[model samples]
Target chain A: MKLPEPIIIDPQSVPSLRWGIIGPGRIAETFVAATQKHTSQRFIAVASRTTGRAQEFASKFNIPKTFANYQDLVADEEIDAVYISSHMSDHFEHAMLAINAGKSILVEKPITYLPEEAEQIFAAARQAKVLAMEAMWTRYLPQSTILRQLLESGDLGKPELLTASFCADNRAVERLWKPGGGGIVFDMGIYPIAIAQEILGEPSSIAATGKVRPDGMDEESYSLLNYESGARASLTISGIATLPMLASCSFENAVISLGEPFFVPSSISLKTKDFYPEQTTWVDESGIAGHEGLSYQATWFAKYLSEGKLESEVHTHAQTVANIRTAFEITKQIGAKPF
Target chain B: MKLPEPIIIDPQSVPSLRWGIIGPGRIAETFVAATQKHTSQRFIAVASRTTGRAQEFASKFNIPKTFANYQDLVADEEIDAVYISSHMSDHFEHAMLAINAGKSILVEKPITYLPEEAEQIFAAARQAKVLAMEAMWTRYLPQSTILRQLLESGDLGKPELLTASFCADNRAVERLWKPGGGGIVFDMGIYPIAIAQEILGEPSSIAATGKVRPDGMDEESYSLLNYESGARASLTISGIATLPMLASCSFENAVISLGEPFFVPSSISLKTKDFYPEQTTWVDESGIAGHEGLSYQATWFAKYLSEGKLESEVHTHAQTVANIRTAFEITKQIGAKPF
Candidate 1:
């Protein structure tokens, strides 16, 4: 496939970056739609492991280019950034290839097979002068940013414990259950881990044990991590059973508890000893998009890129790596079978 | 000390069960009042290390006897049962003495220093033909019983995640920051742990970490535990901070959320997810108890005696032992100075 001319959002003014998705998964689709909607970013191309599937997705989405090979799509100079949303294991090689090709990249959470692998990809990105980041997305969300602000203001008092669980029975998503692709500790686990790292920092000790299933992949994993300051985090992730999927950080004086779907709670409540705690609601900020609550990450990503920022302090590379490291150690502790 | 004449509810009833208070503290005053209020129980004596204090408490409470030594109180035939609410380190000795005295015993929440000690007391109870149980009153509370009923009827769907936190600063209590006691995990943590165990059974694996003060006692503890069935419980307890000390259990379908002072919540809300994906408060059961919730535990103890039940199924000795064992293991893992 040949590189088509870049579709410029503001051709006569500032140049817009072209974004090509490497997989037609749900997240990739969401990313494409968001990019297509955002003028500062362009959804110019997409690629799937299967050419026919890629073409079908391209046709459905009305994209100009689609390729069967990831390497080919990434090599297309018209595309300045590659979004890798395939499987957990595929992340390392795809990220390495994109970094080697000098294209900036964003890989999904639990960015690599192991912490070492994440470090390798990061090193490659650094050595190659190409931007790379884990697509945590949640860190950039409005609620999360607000939460960070609340955390910084010292109003909640000294944070003592942060507990988070992100559980989904995605055994339904077979690609996840397959070897080297997906599993509970990698697929849904990173969200809670990342959230913990956001609030509690890197844990000094990690003790995790859970059922690793007959198929040799973790069906569910629970980890108790201790931070150096004695701050603690309990992270739970599963593909075996469904749960409330919550995130909570307890302070010395009070607590801030986020409701269901820790990834995107419809509402989060700040509660204390005061009688009857109610959730504070946020009015949607006027924007080009309709899903304001859901769109903050992408908008932040665009804003970060346009502003020439290296990384966000709230969701830094170190914390993302720390979160991934904790997940990796927990998976090993649970004896996740080698693929 | 001479035995006081039996105070029986009925002549045909069994002889009044004599009782001795191990700690002549504020709690002893309440226990004496309760024993006076209860028919089948007698307030035999009060004991303190200081002879003056012991006599002072006895005179103030109108007890028939006072002992400067706990061993003598435990040995008294006039005392058929022993209530232990002393410093935690003394519990091991006090309970051992009471058990040896062939007395029915009510040890506080943490039955002893560890699982083995609690087990020993259980075995002693069996050999001596005397009843022994952890004084976990929250389990016997009417609201907690209702919550258990709601849980059994599948009113909240499958039990999922239990988030319970109990935190209280003990600046008001003397000698609370001792090596064997005074921190949150053992002091305020037992109720929440018991509640989780009642709802979810024994966890197969547990990971816990907490804040240890300069004295090496745990000021805060956070634990993530996983049961065999993949149910998760995230529990946090602290002693250095002032918190609502509340608890809530989230299930697959609904959440059983409780209010502050979780040893007893003012209200419990059973929230179910509506078709709109919003939580509907299905049942909000809340109100002021005529008194503190611990009174419920005491009343339940009296009722159990009246009913001739050897062990309470609600807060069974076995369940309490198992939970304390978990707490003991957690304290060990967190290296909280054996407190």
Candidate 2:
């Protein structure tokens, strides 16, 4: 059984998008870098609460315009889309600002601090008749596309279990331990949970245990998601230990192991006893390594907008809501409040 | 910090023992093979329900005597130690028989079908003034000893999370599905649980979920063991998926990863930022691989007896009981009845 190749399209063939960057932080830098290098998406403007930060990011990225605040960029007529990379607690406010301005939007992961906020943002996008998507770049990677095709083909049999972990020593990051937009679950944990939701759908039951700092932010969490089909996902996130960051899907006849930092354009290998003791490692040679894979999502967004699409095909609005809803359930089980 | 060397004693220097096998099963064969190959321990007699099976095993292992029933072998005066490798359900009966016959005993993992039964056997042995232990051979291996010393030294900081998985495709094994001595938790899950207990001690709470077959045996299971120190263990077992069988201990300063089939003599590696990006993979040069490592336990048991020790220091009776009790808790949470 051959795994299908990921859909590849030239950056020149895709219609270019005039994007305004909201909140010029570390992730926004990567998004701008990926688009500028590999895609037709153009970051025409940059916005931060301070003009100095916005101007600095604009000069660094050679963006055409800079706005002191997000509202100005969202209201700009030249901006066709707004990519929200603000702190998670500010996602709802920024997304609402962009959607009210009738610009298409791509909000970063966790969509919002809560599933309800994501629902509100998408609902307003529906009313505005504009494209809306969570920039879950992992879903748009070549390896993820190949993995989805493999799973859909049933070549590995039915997936019986999946395990994923995303742990790093981010304890020194104050925002992670603060009350708002703080915690491993919202930042690091969401990736594994999103992947599990993508493969197994919503869980029938969830069991979770975690350590919450004295300030009420989650230090680490472990969750077991049990599906109706009896498939289980064991996921963990930490601000403490340095984890391998590997993800694996086990099926009746085969197993697929995604390499370290699995939520990226990394290698995925398949092992099965069908050829007993032989494993096939599928290397993703997209020439896009690490965060550079973020470009694929930008190109996808541009192509979807050109086709007048209102939602992402790869990460649907429903899937985004489902992922956040599971996060809510996980936090609830662990007794941690949403930021 | 340097990881300490394992406390190794020459197998040839250990005192010899006259062993009698109460059940000539597959595991019993490995025990006989390990002892014969590496230690001065002698297998004097073999016992099985069938005379033909007993005689065949005796001839293969070059034993001096064969018995159709366990009663005759245990009652034999020449046999000083008896290794019980029968099904889990038969452990209590076999252990009692050996204890009553004034024989030093080593029962295979899970010691008995129930923690209460293990307590009973140990109590009887104490009254009879004979040595008794659970042959959790992983504890006797050099890798396990080194891991223990590392944890004890506090060089890796405090352990905050441990992950272990021991899964195999054993659905075709009928005894694993039958009422007595059945299910993944009792058959395979005990190993990970034991190691976790050894490292972190007993947990304050446990949460578990799994799939049960039509016959009520567990097909797969996942558990979260939460300790008082806020440490957690994520464990999994399966009669379904083929898991990596790797075990990891994550601490504040470093991480220790045990190679696949961690319950065997295998390589262990240490990862820490102290060396920055360099990871030291400590390979086991014990010259024991796979089930051949079972010999280490035989030599350990002989040495303990020669020193007139009544219990294993590495795996005390209390620890054995604690391991079984955790298994009971896991089975209860998964709603599987123990055999």
State the displacement of the C-alpha of residue B123, model 1, in Å, after optimal TM-score superposition.
7.2
Clash pairs, model 2 backbone: none
By lDDT, who's the top model here? 2
* Predicted candidate 1, C-alpha RMSD: 9.1
Q: lDDT by residue for model 2 over B1-339, one digit each (tens)?
A: 666787777878987889999878888898788779877889999889965998999999999899988999999999989999888788899999999999999998878767898899999988887889998999988888888898888888877888888777777777788877657898788899988998889999998887776656788888889899877888888878775677887888888878667888887778873312347777787777788888888888888888888888899889998988988888888888757
Give the true-contact fraction for every prediction, in order.
0.08, 0.42
Q: Which residue pairs overlap in candidate 1's backbone?
A: B267-B286
The candidates' interface RMSDs, in order, read 4.9, 3.6
DockQ-based CAPRI category assigned to the predicted complex of candidate 1: incorrect
Interface C-alpha root-mean-square deviation of candidate 2: 3.6
For residues A32-132, write the lDDT of model 2, one tens digit per residue: 89889998788899899964999899999999899888888999999999999998888899999999999999988878767888999999999999999
